[model samples]
Target: MPPRERDTARTRRTVLDAAARTVAKQGAGVSLDVIAREAGVSKSGLLHHFRSRDQLLLALAQDQVDTFAAEVRAAVDPADHAAGRLVRAYVKAIFDSLGDDTAISEHLLLSAALSTVPGVAEILQRDARQWEAAFTSDGLHPDRVLIITKAADGASLATLYEGGSNPAALERTRELLLSMTRGEGSFTG
Candidate 1:
C-alpha cells in the first residue's frame, strides 16, 4: 500500500480507538473534538474519515457488529447442525466479547445510534432475522428461540458492563443458553 493510504489507515484506527475510549469513559455524549485530541490527531483529520457524527457512530456500530460476526463464524462449525452451531457460536462470542473493555463503548454507541437515529432499528431488526434464520434448521421455533437468546444476551451484557467481577456469571449464562438451544431446559422463567 502507498504511504498515504497506510497513514490514512493508521489515522482511522487512532480515531476509532480514541472514540471507543472516550465513549467508554464519558458515555455517548463525547464530542469529536475530544476524540480527536485523545487520538493525537487534529479534528480535521478525524472528520476527514467520518465526515459527520452520524457517520462515525454508524461506523463504530458496524465495526462491532462485524467483529461479533467474525468471531461467531470462527468459533462454530458450519458443517454441524446449523441451528445448534449458530446458537453455541453466538453465545460463546457474546461472552468472549464482554471481556473487552472497548465493547462497553461499542454497546453504548450502538444503543444511542439505534435510539436516536431513524431507521437504524431496522438494521438491527434485519440482523436479528438473519440470525434467527441461521438457527432455524435445528427445528427450533426461530422467533421464540431468538427471543430467549436476546434476553440471555441482554442479561449477560448488563453484568459484563457493570464492573461485576465474576467469570462464573458469564459461564452460567452461556451454559443456560446452550441448554435452551439443546432443548435440555426451558428458557422461560
Candidate 2:
C-alpha cells in the first residue's frame, strides 16, 4: 500500500480503537471530543474519518462484526467436512475470543454499540441469520447450531462480566463443543 493509504488506515484504526475504549469505559453517550482527545486527534480530524457520532458508532459495530468473522474464518480448516468445519470454527472462535483481552474489551464496546446505535441490532441480526443459513446449508441441524451458538455466546458473555473463568472448565467446554460438531457428544445444557 502507498504511504498515504497506510497512514490513512492507521489513523482510522487508531480512532476506532480509541472510540471502542471510550465507549466501553464511558458508555455509548461518550462525546466525540472525548474520543478525539483519546485518539490524540483534533475534533475536525476525527470528523474527517467519521462524519458524525452515529456514523462512528455504526462503523464500530461493523468493524467488530467483520473482525469476528475473520477470526472464525481463520479458525476453520479446509480439510474438515464442511459442516464440521463450520461448527468447529464457530466454537473455536468463541473460545479464542473469551481468552483474548482485546476481544473482551471489544465485547464491551459491542454491548455499548448495540445499546446506543439505532441500526446496530439489525446489523447483528442479519449477521446471525447469515451464519444460521450457512450452518444449515452445510447439513447441520439448525436447532443444534443455534444451541451451540447461544452456548458459546453465553459463556463468553459470562466470562466478560465475571472478569474470567476457570481455565479447566473452559477447556472442558471447548472439548465438549468440538465433540458435538463431530457428532460424538450431546450438549446437555
Q: Model 1 compared with the native: what TM-score?
A: 0.75
Clashes of 2: 0
Q: What stretches of model 2 exceed 4 Å from their correct place?
A: 100-106, 160-163, 186-189
Model 1 stretches astray by more than 4 angstroms: 1-4, 99-114, 117-119, 137-139, 157-165, 186-189
In candidate 1, list every pair of residues with a backbone clash. Answer: none
Give me the displacement of residue 167 in model 1, in angstroms: 2.6
In candidate 2, what are the lDDT values of residues 1-189, reduced to their tens digit?
A: 999999999999999999988888887888999999999999999999999999999888888888889999999897886566788998998888677656676676657655667888888888888787778776666667777778877777655576776677788988887777776655434
1-189 per-residue lDDT for model 1 (tens digits): 999999998888888877767765666667899989999998898999999776776676566566667888887866666446677777777777666545654565546644555545666677667766677765666655776568656854564466652667667777877777666654443
Superposed on all Cα atoms, model 2 deviates from the true structure by an RMSD in Å of 2.5
The lDDT of model 1 is 0.70
Q: What TM-score goes with each of the models?
A: 0.75, 0.89
